[model samples]
Target: MKKIVIAPDKFKGSLSGIEFCNAVERGIKKQIENVTIVKLPLADGGDGTVDALKFYTGGKLIAAAVHDPLLRPIQARYLYAENEMLAFIEMAEASGVRLLKNNELNPLETSTYGTGELILDAINRGAKHILLGIGGSATNDAGMGMACALGFRFFDAENNLLEGRGKDLNRLTTIDTSMVNTELRNIKFEVACDVDNPLFGPKGAAPVYAPQKGATKRVVEELDAGLRNFNEKVETQFGKNLQNIAGAGAAGGLGAGCVLFLNAELKSGTELIKSIANFDEQVKDADWIVTGEGKFDEQTFSGKVIKGVLDSRTNQQLAVFCGLSELTAEQIAAHKIDYLAEIIQQASGVEDSIKNAGKYLEEAAAQFAANGIVSK
Candidate 1:
């Protein structure tokens, strides 16, 4: 029997990778006979990171009460795989932009204290290895709030405890780690990061991302200055400069915090997920692979799931089925993509396309299969 691997990333605000796999299977099975179908729902260390890991590892979700980005009490969850003693934590669960209202999207006021609490919870639960997905953050505090929750105190020049927020970073005079969780020293951290923005500058976290998180232009400048000051303090405290470290700006400098506070190793998010899934080994003999995401723009070629799947193997009959296919023919050819199946081709409008994403994805896969895209 011919074998096919159906792997897709979440469609962002619509279907998840697992849903995509099921939809595609429902369609392709209607066209193919005596074929083996493999469903591999993948994530790139974003919102669905924990779900993907839980599915792959058969891990248990540990519900924990934590604070949200705005420091309001909220509920969050993380995955713990007992066999491996690994904790898969998506930082967005505690500090995502989606948790805030439009008026409450102020980056300067948000905090990652809840994410730190989750980490501490995992540590106390006997997790020796941690994979933290730092994405979709709503703060630009240089992770001072996270540090604060981990018992790393931040004080002003007067040695008074200052609330950890973006606006307070510039006023931070010292980082005290004397009271940090004792279990932290024995744990290992692997941070999932894809962006290469530095900790502070034009392309840095505050200037590039803070505005999107609801900072005004003037506020962006202030947050950038604060991040720079935070970088200096981090260097003084850790004897390593992170101002220019690639991916250091991720998650309001939570990437840098993981490195300094937890001695984390930063890695590409998709690549890390692929490793955990054992993707290459599992699909070594697959006849064809179908993969995609919400949209396939230029950034998809850089670090997203599509690029990650393509990098895993060459000379395969791989096709991308997405909500929209923005790659030009030349770009597609350069990447050796065999076919592009876009749901928009079957749906009337973009809004309707997303509204009925499962139906469209099923139709797209059916058409692609009818044309021998996957059957061959």
Candidate 2:
């Protein structure tokens, strides 16, 4: 192929996507000689969203002082494209579950208020459209904490203002939008989400996700009840029923909250990334498309980067590579993945594979080009 498109996700504990691209490109260049290589590193609306978009738009990283999930002050960042007036905010940066320690992770007491602060900062910087990546959150307050940062006051039956937490939901009687930052209404919010869970049922936010964030069964029930109360209160106050919205459970009900309060549009993470990347324009005349991840197991069949890339483009000329893959031959045949390479298979052992991921990636790319023996 005269032109090749190399797009990949991060290797988890090893290299970032861009690092993979560079290593692969160097390797490919060693064999391909004169091919054109287009590098596009992708993310699934989670940890790597900012860097992915930054690569796409050449956006500047804007840092703001915000609170972590535990309400501690910290500096977090988002991608800002000044010319496009788009602010890319990953909620995880400000209130991600990873920010908490094992002993500190408590869904009952966490908050998304920091995310709200980031949004406010973006607005102050003249961002007209906000692209919020809602993933890896530490709170289950149904976005109440975020709303608080935007000046939406929550009150108990006694009309007493309440500090936000998952446990605070049961005490909330009504919301005060009269004090909400009116500026939020003018900003268009597009949320990047991948889950389809509802707000408060069996497959809803708390029951499905709270335990992973360190909630006990009792806390899970409490958070679920809190979401129901918040949902009912929202419907009563705003004439909007958000209980059944697909993706309502993403990031601890931040999806539902943004839709209900910020009038945000929810989109699959891949779809949103594709729009910003505009890969169609970049791949129109490409002779080959390469994509991969750390693991290509059954989960890869879902909506992760490799699947996203395959779905986004035809597979006739697509080449697949991964650190480790467990796809059956039938599955590989079904996806029409003709050119495939596994880096782990080329290593001495699993530990050696991960430790020398970049070396193996470069070698794999070169082997795919020079030898054409990827064992597809």
lDDT of 1 by residue, 218-318 (tens): 99998889888888887787788987678999888888878888888999988888888888986799878899898888888788888889887655688
User: What residue pairs clash in candidate 1, if any at all?
Assistant: none
- Decoy 2 TM-score against native: 0.94
Best by TM-score: 2
TM-score of each: 0.91, 0.94
List candidate 2 segments past 4 Å from native: 373-376
Worst 10 residues of 1 by lDDT: 367-376
Question: What is the lDDT of every predicted structure here?
Answer: 0.87, 0.87
Alpha-carbon RMSD to native, per candidate: 2.3, 2.2
lDDT of 2 by residue, 209-297 (tens): 99999999999999999889988888888888888799998888999999977999999787788777887777778778888888888
Query: Taking the candidates one at a time, how many backbone clashes does each contain?
Result: 0, 0
